[model samples]
Target: MILSGTYGELRSNHFHSGLDIKTQQREGLPVYASADGHVSRINVQHYGYGKALYLLHPNGYTTVYAHLQNFAGEIQKHVKETQYKQETFEIELFPEAALLPVKKGELIGYSGNTGSSGGPHLHFEIRDSSQRPMNPMLFGMDVPDKKTPIVSSVFAYPLGADAHINQSQKLTKLRLIKQMDGTYKTEDVISYGKIGIGVSAYDQLDGAYNKNGVYSINTALNNTPKFEVKFDKFSFSETRYLNRYTDYGYYKTNRSKIQKLFRESNNPLSIITNEDDNGFIHVQDSLDYSYTISVKDYKGNDQTVIIPIKGTKSEILNPRAIEETEDFIYSDHATSLTKGKFSVYIPANSIYEDIYLNIKADGDTLIFHEDVVPIHKNITISADISNYLEEDKDKLFLGRLNYKGKPYYTKTSRKGNKLIAYVRLFGDYAVVSDTVEPVIKPMNFSEGKWISSQKELKIKITDELSGISSYRATINGKFILMEYNYKNDVLTYDFGDAINTETENNLKLIVIDNVGNSATFEAKFFRK
Candidate 1:
C-alpha cells in the first residue's frame, strides 16, 4: 500500500521514519499485511510507534505497521510468550524467518494511537532489504486526494548583521490574504536588505479531518525555480535541526512549523534543491518582482501561492530611535540552578522570537507556552557547587535526576560559564550525558552460576545519563545477537545454532554506553 505521508521535514531525532496512516480518527481498525512475508521484528515502545510489527516480504522489501493496538492471534501469542518469559512491559524481538509467516491481505494488527502519537492513527512504511526506509506511496496504496495545501502564515527574516526588513533590522510576519480565485496575495509589499522567507502550511486528505504535513515545496523567482525541496525521505540522524529549518522563535511561541523554502548556509538538511548567496530578493529602484511557491503531496495534489514585491530603496531607521527599553526581573521562585551544566534565563521582554522552554527544580518540570519577544526573558542555571558539594561530591554520584523519568547526569565542577539550564521560548533543551556508563544487571543468571534450562539468556540494562548505546553477545566466544528493548531495559538472546549440546557454555555480554563506556559480564550455562 502506498504511504499517506511524505518524507523530509524536521522531526524528532530522525525524519518521519515512515508513512503515518490515518485510521479514520479511531482505533481498532483492521490492518492488512501488504505482502507475503514472515514476522521478522516486533517492537513495543512507550513513546514511538507503540506496538509496531515488521513483515519481511519475499520481494526484498519490508513493510512496517505501527501504532497498533493488538496483533493477530498467533502473533499475539508469540508476543505474550516473549513478554512473559522476559517479564517486561516493552520488548523488541526478532524471530527466525520461519517462526511466524504471513500472507498478503492477512490481518496482522489493529490500528491505534499508542506511542508519541497525538491521536489515533497507524504509521506505516516500506524499506528495502538493507532496512533503509523508502516512500510507501511508490507501491500503489491508494489515497484519494485532490485538494491543494493551505498556507497558514508567511514570515520574512533578516539574516546577518546590518541586514534589515523594510530598512529595519528586525524579522516580520507578513499579512497574506486569499483571493476569490483561490490564490494568496500579501497585504503589504516587503522591502528587505537581506533576508529569507519561511512558510507555515499543512495538508489534509479529501475525507479526513486530520491536518498533516506537506510532501514537497518549491520556491521560484521570476519563474526560474530558485529552490525546490521534496519531503520524500530523511534520516533520524538530522531531525533535531528542525529548529534551523523554521522560524525557531515563531514556532516556540506560535505553535506552528514554518518550512524554510530558502536554505541558510549553516542549515544541515540534505533536501535543499536551490541556493542563493543572498536569500532575500532585492527589488531595484521602483522595481516590481514576482515570487511563487508551489506545494504538493504524495498523490500529486498542488497549490501555488504568488507574492508580488514592490521594492523601493529607503534609508534605514536609527537603532536608538526604535529601541524599546525594558527591564528583566527574576522572581524568588522562578529560577532553578544546576551546576556543571548549561543554563539559560530569559528576562521579561527580552526575546522577539517564540521559544520552547523547560523550567524545573527538585524533579518538577513545566513547559511554558511560546512567549513573544517583549514579554519573556531567558535565564541560565549556573550554580557554584564547589562551595556546596565540595571536592568529594564528584564521587557521590546522583541517581536518576528525574524530569519526567528522563535522567540527566549531574556533576559538580567549576568550568567556564557554568550555566547548566536555560529557559528559552522554543525547541527542546533537555540535559543528557554521553560520559556515563549504562547499568547492566543479570536477571536470569548470577555472576557465577548456571542459568535455567529455558533455552534463552536475559539481562536488564539501564542508563541514567544518555541511555544504552549498543551491545554485543558471545556464546563460547562466538558473536550472537541480543535484542535491546529500551522501554523495559531488557536484553535477550535466543538459543540458536551458536549454542549446542555442551557440558558448560561461557555466555559473555559486553554492553557499550552512549558515551562509549563498556561493561562486560560472563556466566557459565548448559543447554541440552
Candidate 2:
C-alpha cells in the first residue's frame, strides 16, 4: 500500500508535487515497489531530487523514488556500466521498455537524504503515464493519521485601493485562540471594504512527528465558494511562479511559508479549484457574513475554521501610500537609478511590475535584484580593481557567488560610466575562482586491496570552488559506472557485476572536479 508521511501543499511558483515518506529515523532503509513496473528513467543530479528513479507501472501510473541510497541488484549493474562508459558523475537515462522490470513488494532501492532534501526521508511521488506528478496518498497508502492540522498563522490582504484589514489599509495577521476543544477561533472580528485571506499551516502523521505540508485548501464566503486549490499534482513549468502565490517579501525575510489566503490579481497557480467574483468578498454595509476555510490531507482527514465578519463601513486609520517619482526613469527594459549605488539595464520589455528597489553601497560590494531584466548592466562598485588583479584588465570577469560554493561566470566589463554587469536577475552574486584541488575520502577499504563480501562502495568528495564535476570507476581495470549523488556527495558502486563464483577482483575509482582536478583509488576484494 502507498503510505503518506506528508501531503503536498499548493505552493507559489509550483505545486507541492508529491508526498514525502518518512524513512523511520534515518537513511538506508529498504524501499519497496508499489506495483509491477519497469525502470523507465534514472537521474543523478548535483541538486534537487538526487539519485532518483522512475518506474512505469502497468496501470498507467509512474512512481518516482528520489533521494535514494543505491539501486537494487540488476538495476545497479546497468547504472554502473553506463556511468563508466560516459566517464561522468551526473547522468539522465531513459531505458528501453523491458530493461529493468520490478514486481510489487520487491526492493527497488534504499531511502536517503539526497538532492535538495532537507532531512533524511524518502521523497516519493506518483504520476500519470504523462509524467505529471500526483499525490501518492491517493493510492491508499496505509499511514495512520489522527491529529488535526495546526493553523499556525493567518494573513488578511487588502487587494484594492478601498480594501482594509480590520480598520486599517494594510495587511494584518489575525490572532487565533484555541477553545477548550481543539478547534481554533479568531480573537478579533474583521471589518473591511474588500479583502482576501492567506494561511500558513501544515499537517502531521501519527507514527512520525515530523511536520508536513497540507494537501489542499478551500475558502468560502457566506457558504458560496470563493476559491479552492489542491496540491494533488502540478507541472514543473509552473514552479517559479511561487512568488505570485505567496508574500515574496515575507518569505525572503522571515522564511515563513504563507499561502496567500486569497488569490491576487493575475496570480498563476493552476491548482486553484475555485475562483469567484475576482476572489474578493465585499463586506456589505452594516451586515454580518460568514467565512469558512477548510484544509485537508490526501487521505481525506480535514480541519475547518469558521470566521464571522461583522461588516462596518469605516474610513482608513492610516492609509498606505507611496509617492510617485519622475526623477528615476522606469521602463519595461531597464530601471535607471538617479540616486542609488547601482543602475540596472534590462533588455527591452522585460519588467513585469514597477520594481521597488533597495540599492545601497556596502564597502566594495554592489548588489541588486538579479531577476528584473535579461541584459548586461554593470554595478560600478567603488573598489579599485587594480588592487586585486594582474595587468589583464580586459580579461577581468565578474561572477555571482552561489551558496553551493560554486561561482558562476557573469559577463561584466569596466568602463568610465559604470561597471557593466550582464546578468539575469534574482539570486545573482559576485564571485571569483580558485585553483585549489578537491579532497576525496574513501570510508572503508584502503587504497590497495581487501577480502570480503561487501556489495557496496562508499566515498566522499569535496571541493572549495566549482565543486565536484564528475566521477568514474573501473573493475579489474575495466570501466564501471559510479553514480555521484551530490546531495550527500556520495559515490556508490554495486558489486553485482564485479562478483563471480570464484574468488578475487580488483576495483579502481576516479573522481574529478570542474577545474579538471582528479583523484584515484585502487583496491582488491573477494566476494563469495
Candidate 3:
C-alpha cells in the first residue's frame, strides 16, 4: 500500500496524527481489524473522522479505522439501531466488550471518502493505552521504501539581534550543490555571533510520487551532536506546538514549513533529543565550524548536507530593526485594547513572545495585525452592534476576511449589544451579516411522484453566507435519520429504515443557517 500523508507530518494548526493510506481513488475497499479485539468506540459525524471505529486490543494498544463507508454484519446492525434510537445522524457510542468482538483480519468495514478527507483513503492510527498516537511503522508495519529524503532548501537565521550571517541580519538561503556521491554541500558562510539553521525536506517511498514526511533529522556542529528529532510518537495536546517547532512567521508568508534546528524557549514539543544550546551555534572570531545535517527515512536511506562556516566579522551592511507600536502585548501578562467600537483581549501565554501588534478599527472592520504571529490559545474580539437596526440583529454575525476581502463566518455569540468571537488567527475581522437562508432541494424524487422502486432518498442543501448549521427531517410526522455528507451537500436516507409506514408519505425538511435564517421544504411521495 501507498501513503498520502505521514505520521507527525506538518498540518494546519496540528500534526497529522495518523497515516493516510491511498484507496486507489475509489470506495468500498475491504477493511479488516488489525488485531483480535472488541469494538471499543464508534463515531459518526459530518466532519472529522466520519464513520470511525476504534478497536481495543489486549496488548494495550488501540487501532483506529476512520472514513469508512459502512460497518459489516452485526456491527452495522448495532449502529443503525443506535442512530434510530437517538434520532440523529451524528452519534458517539461506546460498545461493551461483550457486545462486539472480532478476530484479527476479519472484515470490519469498507474504505470511504468521508469526513474532511480530500479523497478516498483510510486514516489509520495506533494509539497506546494512554491514547497517544504512535507511529504504526514502529510496530512492524512496512511499505516499500528504499528512497532517500530530498532536502529542497536550506536557510540560516540570525538568532539574536546582533548575530549576522554573511554580513546580513536577515535570514539567508544557502545554495547547495550535489556531489557525485549523492551528498550535498553549501558554499562557505561568513558569520558572527549565534545563528540557527532551517531545512525544508520531504520523502517519497518506492513507486509512489507523493512527497511524505521523513523519519528523523540530526544536525552536528564540529563533529558534535547539536540537535536530533525523530517522529516516533507524540501526544495530541502537544501537536499545536508545530507552529513553534517550525518557523511560523515564514510559513505564514511563504506557505512552506521550514523546520528550525534550534528550539524556542517556549516550545514544548517532545520530539527533540541530544541537543546543545537548543541547537544554536555561537561563532567566535578566528574559529572555523563544520555543520552537517542528516535527513533519513524509516528504511535507513539517508542524505547528508555539509555546510562550512567561517567566523569572520564584517561591516554591518543590513541591520535588523524592531517595529514598535502603541499596542505592546506582553506574552506573560493579560492585555486588553479598544479602538472605537471594537475591542480585543489577549490572555497570558496566548502568544509565544512579547511583540508589538498593530490593532485598530477601520469602519466596522478590526485589523488585528497580520498572521505572521502565532497564537497558542484563543483570544477574544468584541464589536458593539448597537447601531444595527433591531430587525437586522438576527441576521448579523462575525466574519474574518480573506486576502480577497471576502468575509467568511466565524463562530459568533451575542451578549447584550456586543458581538463576541473567540479566534486564534490574527487577521482582519469584521462584524458582518448573513441574511440569506439555506437552499434545500430534493435530488431523487420530486413532489407528487411515486418512488416505490427507489431504494433511497437524497436531497441537496446549501447556504450562501453563514453556511448550514442544523437540519432536521420528518416523514409522516415522525423524525427520521438523514445522514448528511457535507462534502457533497447531500442528505441520504435508506429505505430499509422503514420509518415510512404508509403508502402515501409526506416529507418535511427544515435547514437552518448559522445566523438563524431557516428554509423549509415539503413533498409528497408514494412508496409501497
Candidate 4:
C-alpha cells in the first residue's frame, strides 16, 4: 500500500480526488476489489482518470479504481463491445445494481499509466452513499508513517482595505524558526485591523520522504478556535472551489499554493466544517495577540506554529499602490462590457469579490485583465468578425495569449457576426484565424505497405496552432480504437480487433483542429 498521492491533496483548481497507490513505477499490477460490491459505473476517456471503475458496496460506500491497463475478461469484453457498437473511444456506463457483483479481493483490473496520470499508479477512492469522496486513510488502509508534518513557511495577510501588516498593505512573508521543543515560532509581526494567516506546508511519511498533503489545519487566536479544516470528506461539485480556498492569484504567479487560514466570501469548499466570522481576527488597540496554527497528518503526527502579533496602529511606510482603472465591475450582478469591436459578459458570482477591471483595447486585441483576481466561472467574450472575408469567417475564432505569448483557443461559438468565446482565464484576447489544417504523419507504415508482422500502428498528429480537437480512424470502414497520447502528439492502434479479414485493407483517418480545419489520411495495406 505505497502511496504516491494522499487523499485531499491540493491540486491545480481541484483537490486530489483519491489516494494514488504506487505500483513501483510499473503497470499491469493486479487490482482487487476492496470489499463485496457491485460494479456501479465504468468510464473510458482520453484524459483525466482514463480507464476507471466504480463499485458500490452494501455498506453504502463506493470504491473507485482509476488509470487501469485492462479490466477483467468479462468487463473488457463488455467495454470493447460497447465501444464498437457506439463507434467511439470514450464511453461512460452505469449498470444495474446486480449486473456485475463481486466479492472482496476479486481481481477487477490491472493498474496502468493512462489518461492524465503522471506515472503508473492506481488512483483509488472511497466515497459515501451520496458520491462524496472520503479520505481513504480513515478507512483503515495502512501505510507506514513516523515523520511529523513539516511547517516550512508562513505568511501574514491583511484581511480588509484598512488592514495593514507591518505597516504595509501587501502581504508579508514570515520566517519561522524551529525551537528547542520541536515547535515552530514566527517573529512578531506588528499589525493592525483585520488580519488572517496562511501556510505553505506539507506532510512526510515514514521510510519515504515524499511530501504529501496535511490531514487537518486548526487556526486559533488568543487560544480560542477560529476554524478547523478537516479533509476527512468532500463533495465533487465543490472540488473546483479549491482555487478560491487558497490564494489563487498568488498561485498563478508562484507555482505553490498558500493555503489561507481564513475563508473567502465566494469559496464554497466543504472542508472547513467550523468557522468563526470567516476565520478573521480583529485587532483594534495596541496590544499583543497570540496566533496559533496546528497542522497534522492522518497518522496524528502534528506540528504547531505560534506567532505573537502586536496590534499596533502603525503608519504605512511602503504601501503597495493600487492600480487605477476606469472599469469597475461589482461582483453581485452580471456585468457587460463593450470596448470598440469586443464585448464581454461577466456572469453574476463569477468573481470572488468586487474588483477594478484594468481593461483596454489595442486594435483587434482586447486586454481584459492581468489574470490577478480569482474568477469562479467562465466569462463570455464576443468579438466582431464581420470584417473578415466570407471564406475566412469560419476560421476566425477567439484566442487568449498565455504568459508565454502563445495563443490558445478559447471555446468559441459563432453568432450572426461575432465569435463568442467562453474563457475561464483572464488575459489578452484577440480574434485569431486558423486556416491551416492539422498535419498527420504516419510513423510506422506507408501507403501500399505489407505489415503483417506489425503488432500496432502509430501516427504523429501535430497542429502547429490552435491544437487538435478530435480524431478518428477506421479500417475497412469500421471504427478502430486508437489511443491518443496528447503529451507526444502520438496516436497508437493495436491491430487485433478492427483488422480486416480480407487480404487487402484500406485505412482512413481524419483529424480536426480547434477552428474546424481538418486533414485526412488514406492508405492501403496487406494484413497477411
Q: Return whichever of 2 and 4 wins on TM-score.
A: 4
TM-score of each: 0.62, 0.77, 0.97, 0.96
lDDT of 3 by residue, 187-232 (tens): 8888999899999999998778988988899999999999998999
Best by TM-score: 3
Model 3: residue 429 alpha-carbon error in angstroms: 0.7
| Better lDDT candidate (1, 3) | 3
For model 2, how many clashes? 27
Q: Candidate 1: minimum summed lDDT over ten consecutive residues — where?
A: 363-372
Alpha-carbon local distance difference test for all models: 0.63, 0.66, 0.91, 0.87
- Report clashes for each candidate as comma-separated counts: 40, 27, 0, 0
Q: Looking at model 4, which ten-residue stretch has the lowest summed lDDT?
A: 203-212
Model 1 residue runs over 4 Å out of place are: 1-14, 24-26, 188-192, 274-286, 318-528
**What is the descending lDDT order?**
3, 4, 2, 1
Q: RMSD for each model, in Å, please?
A: 11.4, 5.8, 1.3, 1.7
lDDT of 4 by residue, 344-422 (tens): 8999989888888988788789998987677778898898877888888888778888777678878888988989988
lDDT of 2 by residue, 1-528 (tens): 223345455343445677777665589999888889899999987678878999898888898999887777788778776866776657899999788889999998998877777777788889886777776667766777777777888777766677776778776888776667656667555576777777888887776656677777888888998888887666665555566676666765676778875666445667776788757778766888877788886556777776777777788786876544443334344444433434544444333344444443343344554342221223332223554445334433455656563566455556643445655455544424345557777765665456364677777777765466666667766666565666566776666555334456677766666545677767766655
Tell me how far the alpha carbon of residue 122 in candidate 1 is from the true structure, in angstroms, after superposition. Answer: 1.6
Q: Estimate the TM-score for candidate 2.
A: 0.77
Tens digits of lDDT, candidate 1, 265-343: 3456765655554245655556677888878877777777787776666676733133232222343234333323334
